[model samples]
Target chain A: MNKRENERNPVETPAHDAAHDALAEELEALRDLFQKELDRAKNAPDDAALPVKDGAPDAPPDADEGPVCACCGAPLTDADADAPYCEECLTQMRTRPVHAAAALFVLAAFLLAAVGLYLFSDSAAQWRQLFSAQRAVQEHRLLDAADRYGDCFLMNADRDSVSLTGIKAYADLCRSLGDVDLAALLVDARFPGPLLKLPWNARYRALLKLQAQFAATEQVAIDIFGAYDDYTDAAVYEDVDAQLCALRTDDTYAPVAVEYIRYLLMKAAGKPAALQMQQLEQMEAVDDGCYTGYYLAAMIELAGETGGPDAARTYFQTAIERNGQDQNAYDAFVRVLRRQPAPDTAAIFSVAQAAQANAPARGKPVWLRLFAVSDLLRGDDAQALREMQLYMTACYEQQLSLTMEEWNLYALCAAAAGDEDACAQIETALGSAQLKLSPVIGRVRAGTWTAAEALRKDGGDIA
Target chain B: MNGIDRVIRVLTAPGVWIRSFWVHLLCRIWAVPVTETRLFQNKATFGHLQHMAPPTVGAAFAIGFVPALLNRLLALLLFLSSLLGLFLFRMTGWVALSANTLAFWFAFSLYVNTYPPAEHARRMQTMLRGQGTRAQKILLAPGTFCCAVGSFLERRGVTFLLACAGLAALVLWQGALFAAIARWLPNLEG
Candidate 1:
């Protein structure tokens, strides 16, 4: 088999040897030619003389060659034989005296034209109307302001920035006057069918439709939504609450009722936590899918404030059982657990495990981070380090950045796990400016520090 | 550079080149002698002009505004005429559409090239800080500031992108407006 293979692929056949010999001869010829050229170049004179054609020396042109331009070597026309430079060159060299007067006249003409065009422009009219509307509002001439604003909108309803500004101003004026019908009319006229087709205008169109719906019903709902800008006024909240209560039982208005309740909870000051919790529960009862995880989180918070951490934990546990997919419930549970005088690490770990199991692809990093934190709190440094690595890998997969606090936690875990290389890598990645817990990392590695103490020193909350 | 960078450079070259030509022309008219002119891959350069006197803010403003105002007027005319022909006249066919497209591209190129170069802006700034009268300064402040800012933004191609966005928005607005008018005209006749 070896003999047959060698016969099939001979290393040095006669044809190959012949081709090699031919290549070597060609290379030798080229080398000889190159050497000759090199010798000729070396033997050449300092200012190498031009090679003569047919062994003839250079000679001057006959006078019959005719005159040429002195500046450019182009043949001069007989009509301009005395001229030294070519026509083109002459024109280039010729400098016309500054036409100062003509230039100033032209400048004046352009400036006047610009000013004239601007003064009579549609944009100018729009600007004037906008200014008048603003001045009218300042002077308390609501009627004039509305008219001017309407004119501005009609003139430029297709202009996003200008039309939006005018519409917003008109809406504000109408709302201040408690004229829902007029506000609805303003939005409808400004945002016609074609304008509403634009993607950016969809929200405005929805708002207009919502206002129309509410206007068809009790105008009080519109008033409650639009007129309660002053949060400090007890009278405003009382009025809003009264209107919301009246609409609470109507299924058509339940979403509005829920929104106003959430708004009041967020904006209303000095309201008792128990009352807030009561309102939240009422909102949830009538929510009709309008209830978000945020409301549950708020309820948990209020429960913790009014009924202590145990109550909050119960509420969070109930929320998780009701909707395990709700990340907010897990967050609230972890928060409430961590706030205890002595946190139950086992419970925290279990909640984190449940959260990780239920988390969507986007939320996995957050849950993994929570798991790492729980392990760190449990004093299982190596386990925490492993969890942190997993968390970072998850974050990388999701293209999410680790917060400064998370970086600090990772460094702490690395130090406490006695992984010097990992600690050094973290320090290099974070830089000294961002690694606020650098001093504490060393102490934690020395077994004289804790993650909670490092967090405290770095002005980060343990929770 | 990468493909997108090369494409952008190619796209922006004409505007810069035209602006350089205008600058050189304006310098000559102002009695500054331009010794030579040279064109490059993306920009043009003119030989240094002999300044008889320090450039005044007013002169700088006029130099910047003349070509810019002319170009803006031409662009606006082209834009409005195209809109009218397409919507009101109901021009159809590839011939009309191609004409309108060419007009639109030309108008866009002219608009992009309207801003003065950075040298004019620097001259304006120096004169504004040094020797201009308060009334003169006040009168010229808004125009000069806009020129300076436009110059800066143009170099980074931000102005070109903004102009493109504005044109897109304008086309959409005009389309919507014409559609609404067409829909309403029939109802009113009925």
Candidate 2:
């Protein structure tokens, strides 16, 4: 059957052979070309192996043979290997026309946004005015600054940083211009609650109000309290004695008189003790019920300085007799006792016990701390630790920071109790505050010294 | 580049991309033909434009001016809002705190990207030098000067440093103000 078919289609057979020959020849030619290109690529230098331009006669036969430009499909040079596009494509892209409609759309959007923001949000304008005010202040243009600040205050009443800072700055400017009343008014109007509670702000307003009530000649007395509040130069208080005497006649200014006298007594480091005692005496004579604990405390301090430990003891007895419930008198007596070369721990413990029994809830931390100190002095480490724990707890409950001496005593007690962790923590706390354990406490922490040794060093009898 | 410069470039790469995006976007808005936009490695380039005419003063000024203004406005808004959210809103718990922190980060990023790139600033300088009215030059002079200075500083990474210092100062000032108020105010937790 095949022979018959071949015989019937003899012309078709030759034609098919001819077509096959042509196809084979073409395949052979392609194979040879590919081989030659592969050879050339192998023989080429590193630079020559770079991406050849598309349609170039010397282009690599296969696209996958090497890296090519992402944009143009040309083989990339070694230098351009890291680059996604060839230099030509990059150049072409650089010159490409931007979409005009899209560009206009974006431009319109931005313009609309700018306009919308300017119309809707007044913050930008307020901030600009605020900056202008700050600049005016820098240039000493107080009036312009004040005006700008006034504008700011009217613009925003929120207690944000900008508003608060503006309020503070405006008040400062008003004060600088000698318009204390205006400053007070502005602060009172703007800061309703917390800001007015600050000591300086309260004092500033008080001074202004008091000055308004008094004549210009009597303003100096009000100024004295202001100066004292501000910690003005001590020389300003040089004639404070006469000032207090003048202020004492007015019952309204009696508190001021008492405060100045207390200041004089406490800060009278270089001044003669006799002068401070006389002032204290004057305060006592004019005293109202406000002359409770602080008066007795100050007198005890002065008495210790003037008449020795025995005299201080006598004053303490008198103070206790005057008011056994006053925590400050007991605190002062214990402070005086502790300062002695040989502190009477028994007496301090007894005094602390009495103070603790009589002290108000607010005054409990003071007595607790004194008890701990007395226990520490007596070398009763366990009792001292227990007392200090109570003292610290009481202080924490009251939200009070420990005084420097209290911190020292706490650390010493911790060391005497062999609490390394507490000692380390205490050290860290003190170190962060730029303070260090006292030398005796440091020795105790290192285990080189004992509480008895510390007592002996301080001339205290261990018994 | 030195190691520090390289690190700074890498760190500021996102800021550079943001700035370039603004410039390109603005270019399109002005109908200026941009050839290409390339963001690779630590570099970002918005291709040259086919200026149909001598660049207008408004176009030149707006190209750098608008983006810078927006960046500052956006940053300030974010910063103040974050501060308000943290303090005023009295938002408690870690989630609100985290959100506020993220806002602060975004605000700082925007502040760092406030200045245009050196190329955009150069383009601005060229347009400013081109023919324009005397009044236009006087009006745009400050903007031009600021762009030049900002670009100069941005190249040297000084703007990044300045942004950091400025953010720190803002935080410290706000913290001090809030702390002072909080000291006397009733407990927010309650």
Candidate 3:
């Protein structure tokens, strides 16, 4: 810490001394490795010496000289050999190129090979093609998709087969095209493998047109008959008929499906009553009864020909047994009873009352309104008021439109029941409309919608 | 060992086989001159100096002989194109001549990369005052010149003959350097 010490060489300081000690340790380690190298050299063969200035391989050894290499403990090879290392030690110590550079070269070569494989391999190309084809399908690029798909299939077909996904995609393509010929061809190529679970029967009726009889499968028959809706054009009648004929032999069609098929055929061909009855009997003999209120309503066409209201009553009972929620069946049965020569007034009233109690909040039976309105028409003021109150309350809760006429009927029912308060609520909602005798709601469309065109045109003004 | 000792160990670790070289350079204590170093090392032994002279001569001869051998080998590999102009008196003789010229020029560049070691060795030796004997130069100069020639011949299409010639000379140069090392470098290591 004094000036004298400060002026001295830094190497003598504590820190420098520690560094020197570390350096000595490093040298000692290096020397150990050098010693090993020399020992290895000495064990090789008899030592050879270069002819020195003395011109004598057997020159007299210097008395003061000792071993040159510390480890070998052998005599020095030359007169002034001051090197601590022997020949082998020097060989081992030769500097080598940086290993990181060499390793980088190797890694680069490996990546180059990987990139080459991806670029040039057939499988990689096929994978890319398949990917492009899928992209094209998503973008609705049908031509590009077809081209890429064709290339992909051809690429694989030469050696293997299209994967299950590829086959499924082809099936999907056929379905999307919806051309009978194309569907048949592609479906035949794909089959039960891809279609085994995917709307099998619907797709079959659509794509399996080769035999026309494919429609006959109970599944296909169901799909064909059920195919008609406001959203889709009806399936071909010939296809439906062929499938129906086929379904007669197949036992898979449930009774409801057969009844639906008969209903469709009756509507399609305007078949005789006897033919429909025969079909209904055949349907009734099939799968456990699946007839619902919809089916019973369809059966209402045969009502006058069969056992009259009794037959419809039986159908309604069967429908209730099959699907207890068929309020439409309940409504239809009440209608049939009310239409009878000597109407079962109590039965109709009770059926209407029971339907009101049974109706769910959403999709309540369409005929519940029918029964209430029919009761009103029959002048059973108390029962009509009760049923109509239940129906109108539901209409309000369900956000269903109650055509202007329906509101007036509700108001009339309330008046008949002497529920001035209920009539007041309706009048208030209508903004003081005095047209309580309006016949706007004389009939309703099975309660599918409550709003009639006039109410919409009148901007929902019940008045 | 302090830091100085560590540095000394590293500098000396390659084994100062020719320790006298350092003393001659740094201590201003010169070894026998290039000519007399070998002679004076065994000046007392009459026959010892005699033995050294022959190897130097042999090394020079071998150095010269190597290039000649390489030249002939190249001649042979040249598809005997070099001989075509010598014998064929055809009107198209100039064509083969031109081709031989182009081939030699192109093939010479193959040695451009191989010349640096000889040039570096010579430069280092002169810088360190450890110049070897004439025999070393005899070995080094031809390869360096051939590499120069080869580099100039770039884009002429490789002449396998000249390339082989340069490589052979390079090998000869290495051999000569080794001989000179044993003879003169004994006292030059720093």
What lDDT is reached at residue B70 by model 2?
72
**Model 2 C-alpha lDDT per residue in residues B1-190, reported as the tens digit of each score:** 2344345545544333444456666766764434344444332222222222214667768877777777677667666655554443222234445555555555555566666545556656666666446887888888988987886786576777887786567555763654345344443220
Best-to-worst order by DockQ is: 2, 1, 3
Choose the strongest candidate by lDDT. 2
Local accuracy of candidate 3 as per-residue lDDT tens digits, B36-113 = 112112112110111001112223223223333333333343323322211111002233335444333322321221
lDDT of 1 at A350: 86
Which candidate should be chosen as best, given TM-score against the real structure?
2
Candidates' C-alpha lDDT: 0.59, 0.59, 0.43
Candidates, DockQ: 0.02, 0.03, 0.01
Classify candidate 1 by CAPRI docking class: incorrect
Instruction: Indicate whether candidate 2 or candidate 3 has the larger DockQ.
Output: 2
Give the distance in Å from residue B114's predicted Cα in candidate 2 to where it truly belongs: 94
Off by over 4 Å in 2: A1-252, A255-268, A272-274, A321-323, A360-363, A433-440, A443-463, B1-190
- Candidate 1 chain A: minimum summed lDDT over ten consecutive residues — where? A1-10
lDDT string for model 3 (A1-463, tens) is: 2211211211121223445678999999999998997887777665432224556766666755665654355654663245444445433322222233323422433343343233234344554555565555554444445556667666665343234344445555544432234446655654444334466346554345422433344456556667754312234555566666655555443334545565566656656666676666665564232222234554653653466876777767665554444555665575566545556667766776655454433334244465655565566657766877677667777778766756765775666556678767877787664444344332222233232232223222222
TM-score of chain B of each: 0.72, 0.71, 0.20
